[model samples]
Target: MTVSIWQSNLPPLREVDFLIVGAGLVGCTAAYFAAQAGRQVVITDALDVALGASSRNAGFMISSVDVYYHHAIAKYGHDVTREIWHLAKRSQALWYEFINRAGGTVKFQRTGSLLLAESEAEAEDLAQAADAMLADDLNIIHHKTDPLKRGYFAAIEQPDDGAVQPFELVHAIRQQSGVSVIPNNELYHITQHDDKFVTAYTRMFIFKARQVLLCTNAYSPRLHPYFINKVVPTRAQCLVTEPLVAPVLNTCGYSDYGYMYYRMTFDNRLLIGGGRKQNIALENDTTEDRVTDPVQQVLDNYLKRHFPDVTVPVSRRWAGIMGFTPDSLPLVGVLPDMPDVGFAVGFTGHGLSLGAGTAERAVNMMLHGTHPGALDAKRLEPAV
Candidate 1:
C-alpha cells in the first residue's frame, strides 16, 4: 500500500499531462522542466521534499564518477568513460543555473573536491587517475601535500567540483509555476492508458498523465519489481558537527574511492558520511533513518585520525539509503515494455553530483527519443 502526505494542505489528485513519481532532485527538476514546456505535471513522493537520499545527502556536486575516469575507462572503455565525464561537466553547469534562477540560498560552494590517498600505492593510483582525467580535459590536479592542512592522505583536487544545499534546491524548484508537488504520496502501481499513464497510490486516488517518470532511487524496487534485483539498497551514515571556530576542511575530501567523505559546510561545520562497506549487511536496507553503532565508530575513528586537534561536538547524526547497481553507473532511460514510462535510478550514491544531468538526459529521451552522450542506454537498460 502507498501513503499520501501532502507538503502543502492541497486538494485531492487531478489528471495531468505528466506524472512523476518520487519528488527528489531528479523528479522535481524534471517536473519543473516538463511543466515549463506547457505540460500539466504532478510530482508525488512518499515523503516530504528532500526527505529521501536527496535531502539527507552531503550535497557535494562532484564532476566525476564513483571510480576515477581511468578506472571507468578500464572497465567500460575509453569512449564510454569520456562520454560520462562530459555529461558530468554539463550537469555541474546545470546545477549552477538552477541555483541562480531559484534565488535560493543553497550555499553553493565551488571549493573544489579532493580525493586523498592513504598509501604510496594509492597515491600512485591517484596520479594515474588525474592523468586520465586531464587527458579528457577535466579540471583535476594531483597534489602531494594536504590542501586542508589535515595530514591524512595525499590528494587529487578537481577544481570544477562544488556543493549545494540539496533540500533547498529541491524546494525552490518545486515553487515554480505549473508544477504541483504532492509529498508523502507513494506510487504503488503504474498502468498504461491511451496516450497516457495511470498511476495508483494508496490514497485511493488515481492520477492520469500523458507520461510518467520513476526517479525513486533506492526505494524504486517497490514500484518496479524488476528493479528489485537490479538495484540494491545501501545505507550511508552521516553526521554534522557543531560550527567550528576554524573550519578544518575548506574543500570536500574523499578517501578510499568515496568510502569516506567529509566536507566543511558553509556555516563552518564538518559534514561527513560513508563507511557502509564496514557494515555491509546492516547497510543493505531501504530504511532511511537507522544509524548503526559500528558505522558511527568508523566515523569517529576517521575524525580522530584525520583531525586530531579539532574537538567539535557532533550536532546531528542520521542515515540515508542510496541505490547501487551491478555497475556503479545510474539507470536513466525508457523501460523496454513501458513506452510511456521512463526512469532514472540506481545512482550508487553519486546522484548528488550527477543527478541533474541524468534527469535532463532522461527527460530528453522521454520527449525526443534521444539522450545526451553522457548516459549509456545499455548501462541503464533493465537487466534481462
Candidate 2:
C-alpha cells in the first residue's frame, strides 16, 4: 500500500480536525463517536466503504470473543472475559440504534444465535461453557441435544445475539454520522509533527490533523511499524447458495468451535463460512481477499454433509482479511512514538461483535484520555 513518488504529488496538503483511517465498520463507528464529540471528522479508505471484511463477514453478532465463553475465561481471566463480553453487548446495542435510524433501509433480525457442537468432545465443552455463563448470570440456554437436527451433538443458545446486513449497516452508520469521506484514498505514512498536529501521507492527499485514529484493522500493520507483530492479517472465506424455496436455518448457527457458521440470508439464500481450520497454512497471515479451492472445497463438503437439502448452486464466493491478535482480544492504544495516533484494531474475526464498543473506547481515550479497561494495549506488554 506504499504510495510511489509518481502517485504522491497530486493534491496540496490539507488540515483536518480529526482524521480517521479505514472506512469500514470500525472506522465509521469511530467517525460516528468523534462527530458526537463535535470534532470535524473525515474518513479515508483504500477501497470504498464497507468493501473489506466489514461487509464480507457472515454477519453474526455473537456477544463473545472468537472462542466459547469458558475458553475465553480460561485464556484471559474471569474479569477480563466478562468485560470483553460486555463490550460485545455494547457493540450490538449501538448497532441496533444505528439500524433503527436507518428507516427500513438496513435489514436485521433478532433471531438469536446457536453455538452447536460437531462432536462429543465439543458438546462436553459447550456444557462447561454453559455452566460458566450461568454462574456469571448470563442469559443462555443449553440444549443437551441438537435443536436443529442437523447432526450436531449439542448447542448453546444466546438469545441476545442476532444477524445483520453488514454492508448496509456500515453505510447507514456513515450516513448517520454526517462525516465527509475521501473514498479510494489509501494512507501510506503517518507521523506526529508535534503535540498539536499529526501529518499523514496518502494516495490522494497529505493531511495534517489535530488528531488521528486508525481503525484500519487488518491493514494497520501495512500503514505503520507499530502494528507489525501485534496485528496479524488472516483471511476468511465464505460462500452463498442461490435462493431456496423455504428457509432452512431459522437462526445463526455456529459450529466447529466457532470456525464454521451458516445462516439464511434475508432473501432465503443459505450463506456459510469458515473452512480455514483445515487450511490454516494457506489462510493464515495473508491479506489476499481471494478464495482458494482447498478452503472452498471444505465448505462444500460441510454444506453437503450437514445440509443435504441445500442443492442449489452457489451464487457467489468471497474472502476477507481479519486482524488477529496474540491474546484474541482487540487492542486499544496509541503508537509508542506517535502518542496522538490512537488505534483500535485486532478484532480477531469478531469485529461485528466488538467494533462499535471498541471504537467508542478508542475515541474516548484519544479525545478525553479515558482508559479502555480490558482492551488497553498495555495488557499485552511483557512484565519484567
Best by lDDT: 2
Itemize residue pairs with steric clashes in candidate 1. Answer: 5-183, 5-184
- Model 2 residue 208 lDDT? 88
TM-scores, each model vs. reference = 0.91, 0.97
Candidate 1 lands at a TM-score of 0.91
Minimum summed lDDT over a 10-residue window in model 2 is located at 1-10
Instruction: Score candidate 2 by lDDT.
Output: 0.92
Question: What is each predicted model's overall lDDT from 0 to 1?
Answer: 0.77, 0.92
Candidate 1 residue-wise lDDT, 51-130, digit = tens: 88888888888877768668889988998787777777877887888888876566688878889886677778888898
Scored by TM-score, the top model is 2
Tell me how many residue pairs clash in candidate 1. 2
lDDT per residue (tens digit) for residues 217-313 in model 2: 9988898877888899999999999999999988996899988999999999999999999999999999998999999999999999999989999
Q: How many residue pairs clash in all the candidates, one count each?
A: 2, 0
Looking at model 1, report the run of 10 residues with the lowest lDDT sum: 1-10
State model 1's lDDT: 0.77
TM-score of model 2 (CA atoms): 0.97
